[model samples]
Target: MTNSIKPRLLLEIIAVGILAFAGVLTKTAANVAFPAMMAAFHINLGTVQWVTSAYMLTATLVIPMSAYLQRSFTSRALFLSASLFFTVGTGLIVGAPSLALVLVGRVLQGVGNGIAIPLMFNIILMAVPRSQRGMMMGVGTLITATAGAIGPTYGGLLVDRWGWRMIFIALLPLLLGSLVLGLVTIYGERRPARQPFAFLDYGLLALGLLLILLAQNGLGEAAPLVSLAEYGLGIICLFLFAYRSTHTATPVLNLAIFKIAAFTWLALTYFTTFMVFFKYVFRPTQ
Candidate 1:
């Protein structure tokens, strides 16, 4: 039993590792192609910023609902859905004639990324023994980090050689390959107990996140007073979202995770570190 289980865990790790690499690569790689896209699409930097924001916001909004989705669908079903969304989205972006269509494609990719990321982690935890989970997670992190580090340079080279659309086209084979592995290897994976999704939980949570992200992104573009008001409104919506999440029996955002003091502190630390690093990095560029 142990021998058989170890090989299965290895296979899942390889599959999930590819997913992780693709997720990180997608974000970092697209960033480098922004200048090329701006020139080709005949758009200003601000307008083209939506290319990244649309994907990020969609991913952020979808992440909170992942648990609900996992419960509503089988692991195999979720994996295939993620791959399908990613593949179709990449195709659309590659062939898109307008910024609007590109944004739509990006949104689809973001949804796929959101689902794949959490699902990959869940699969690893379920497949690997507890003793090996830490090591495997470390390996997964390394894969993502390496991909991220390489993405900007790789994307730039591809864009320079073949044009901006090539960025999306380049990943087609890898995405399809991951899908094939998933189809073959995801058999006998765990299934979740069925749960009916609540509109209140999904809707408010997404609305709150969307408002906050938009407000933050608009800080530099909007007038000072308007920005302030938008920020205030976003905060209010977030507060309401938190209240609703806690009160609801089946909270989509899972506020209960904050009950763990360690997680709360760790999360705060990460947020602060990110903010500090972001300002340090982007302040000079601006």
Candidate 2:
């Protein structure tokens, strides 16, 4: 901490951080509520698990679009949209009578999260002074980490007392606070891209991701041949998506960043570690 920071500047970061935190918290907390959710809907474990899957899948798909979103829209617009999507999704989840609606709500929440996460980093880099960026980035990461860290415990306690929907209900005030703070603190600045949307790139990417997730989710249950076909198709789609991204002039994702040897290795390391840990944590307890 070399130099002192402006109050409003910090508030701006706090606004986005809170939004991101809420999104992360929702995702993690809902996992603890799965048992309650299944009982409430009279569904089995596999079926109820889609609540988390729908949310994660939607978030994963939307994440790749974040780079494009930043290029096309103002930070203020994006944050506001995120807030709205999240709020509406929470509402739907709280009021849902059927599992179908719950899944839809989770998907909407995922969309909000996917936007808020990248947008948080975008804002920090764009708004925070270079000297203070590291600290602010840490603050942002702390907010996210804290949310995920305590989410399971928080959900467990709340679900035990007030039921599964209470997990979302508890977030209403936080969501409103974020929206209000965003209105006051978030700025409107746009640097629109001058490039055509490459439908093929995003199409392949989305299809690939969907296939991969579906195949993974259905691994034990689905027929061997079907699973193999899906895995094969998914890999091919991703390969095409990557090839197109590298070769295109206005790529949705800048694959060039991975050209840095250190960065590529670090990313792979992080991905593999997170995947292993994630499976361990999310595994169904027998």
Candidate 1 global TM-score? 0.90
Sliding window of 10 residues with minimal summed lDDT for model 1 = 277-286
TM-score of each model, in listed order: 0.90, 0.95
What root-mean-square deviation over C-alphas does model 2 reach?
Answer: 1.8
The model with the greatest lDDT is 2
Please give the CA lDDT of all the candidate structures: 0.76, 0.85
* Local accuracy of candidate 1 as per-residue lDDT tens digits, 15-133: 65676577667676777677777888898777777877888788888777788887778878888888888789889999999989999999999888888878777776767777777
Expressed as tens digits, the lDDT of each residue in 186-237 for candidate 2 is: 8776667645778889999999988988887777885877888899999999
